[model samples]
Target: MLRRSKRSSSSYYLLRRIALAAKAAKGEQSRCGIVGRSSSCSCSRFLTTGGIDDGEDDHDASTSSSSSTTLIKKRINDEYVDTEAAMERTRMKAAALKAAGLKAESMTVFDREVKRAHRDRAAYLQREKKEEKEKKSSSSEGDFLLEEATRRVLDRLDDIKRPFKRILVIGGATVSTVKQLLEKRRDVETIIACDSSEATLLLVKDIVGDAPKRKFDSFPVEIKYVQAFEDDLPIKDNVVDCVLSVLGLHWVNDLPGAMGQARCTLVPDGLFLSAIFGGDTLTELRIACALAETENEGGVSARVSPLAHVRDAGNLLGRAGLRLPAVDVDTLTLNYKTPMDLVEHLRMMGEQNAVIERRQTIKRSTMELANQKYVENFSALSLSNDDDASMPKPSSSESGISATFQILYMTGWSPSETQQKAKERGSATVSLSDLKSALEEKEEEEEKK
Candidate 1:
């Protein structure tokens, strides 16, 4: 009498377990009547055997088969349960991720907006550069202002009696500054032109022709072009003698970071000079858009990118590890034919709004009303100025609207051994009391006068 081994595989006992317990337990029959002694699962021999009824053995075999089947079923059920639980967990995680994505509002931020502005500006310049080149005159009003700013920086350099050897122009609009420097500051040896927008860079031909061939100091001035973000200049530390940006820093998201990089790129006593639009730029358009949106769309959206304050520029420079930071404002009031004309000029000049969280679309009515309101409120059109024939007009002054573009100028000098340094604690030559007395004496003299 042999019993099946308990350690047998589940597959081996699977069929035996699936059968009825009574049938599987059919006991040891005669080995002589058409039966093989080695057979473990088949029950045909039980019925075929001659007159040997082992009912107890048959019951035991049936029980063993039933138990084996129950064990296999239990294992299958456990695996199925585990698989279902894992699937459920995966579904829950996916749902959570979807909800999280939906919850994040204002998907665009300032940095992303600036990057977009640069990319689009590049594309735009590439498309219209030929037209621009053909129509180029003494540059636009904005360009004139940038040139003036660059001149101011050059003058400041003169006042300091310092000469720049290597200069980096941080924005495409300031490419003229390089030529201006090369012509004016003959000591300058190299010029690095960097712009985030390739299209903007393409416009460099208008400012700088293939003309570094005009030698300086027994060698041709070196000209290098690199596409780089303001916050991330690709130059060695203390390599550039000056960093100049014109009508450009206003578009940067991280002004302080960019300024810091400028400081890092400059040699000791190097100068960082830049001019950017202040918060007052395009005030009329911003107001008109907000008013129209509120009147028509029930709420207002960001229609313009906010510019920086001149006051904040000084702090930004100090934080960038520069010395003697200076910030000042220069406001230029320009007249336009219409608000739309002003907008067109901005587009042409690559000054499109790069603000994140801007309105995806403006309603037709909203835009129409905005334009109407702009004409009514900002333009110089009186009731009598209306043409009943609706004749087309030429030039911006026809509609006669004025927009303010406030330019903020910033200057900071890279650290040098000769530059004035703050005195350490108790290191001053004069005591606090002595300084107070001197101030009092000065006030007394003024009062006496």
Candidate 2:
């Protein structure tokens, strides 16, 4: 009985080994490279020989030894070997991405998935913070820029003096902005708020729905929420009367595609007003990070996401098929007590590095190095009471960190016959030089009179 039990146990063990080997052969395999060791060391022998060694194998008596070995060898050669080769090719491609001093010039610079995750996390944290305080505040400190941008953009809507029945608010919404929009825009019957993060949508829905009494009572606007990316808006084309995005378009990987979609969503002659971070936004931080990473790690990665230049706004509008596009820049410089404060503010704003090839983690030493570099290179003297009023005042510290945010305000209208169109080329009735002379003659005649 004891001899029979031992034989059965050995057979079971042999079968399990075969099963695991077959499974491994069918799936892609990966091994992390250890310090001072090759990642493919253990698999090197198996890979070289093509199959399990006969001396180490304990096969079933009923199975033909040569046939079983041949089957396993074929599986490893066909599936396992090809998978490793493919993985090697991918590694080579990734290595090429690590070239020093190379800018993130590709269209695939930002990872949309990472951006979505960060926004969701940021929204969750913000909600938790508000709950901890047991009060619904108008806005948080990090959201100051967002609220300001929304206010400025919405103010432009007043200049048009037209009623918009349905408005699409791209990006997320804040408490103060929602209140301001509701109280100001009496003609807005519906507001469709779209964002990439589900948590953001839920939080905004709750806050706006539970706003203070009389804040939105008189306006009576219907606020709706949709979860979608900025570049890939899911709404039907030519639906909304207006599309407004504040401090949101900057994160889009394809700004032109996003703008094109926005134009298509607007009704004929509908307004498209937006504010995005310009190219020079956070120039100080970007430089500091680059220098620090180079000094510490012997290479630089995209610590700060790239932004569109103010000059690109007009051209992007033209590409998006919008009419009468106007682009302007608003530079907002803030003085922080420390560089770390600025970083925290960016996190609260849900604007962090989301580059696809970015390092998974930033070392503590690297952050310290970056902070020192930021202070050494970008620190400015605090403005006193006697200083010029136009200049921004820094914190109480002797030397305050300067962080610049360049906001690009863009306004475009959908195509319509009622809108003014430029005349065809060479069809002008008067020449520019002749018109100038006529104006000068008119001025002389007026002087004689």
Q: Which structure among the candidates has the greatest TM-score?
A: 2
lDDT of each: 0.59, 0.65
Clashing pairs in 2: none
lDDT of 1: 0.59
Which residues of candidate 2, in runs, are more than 4 Å off? Answer: 1-107, 132-142, 172-176, 210-217, 380-398, 438-449
Residue 112 error, candidate 1, Å: 4.7
TM-score of model number 1: 0.63
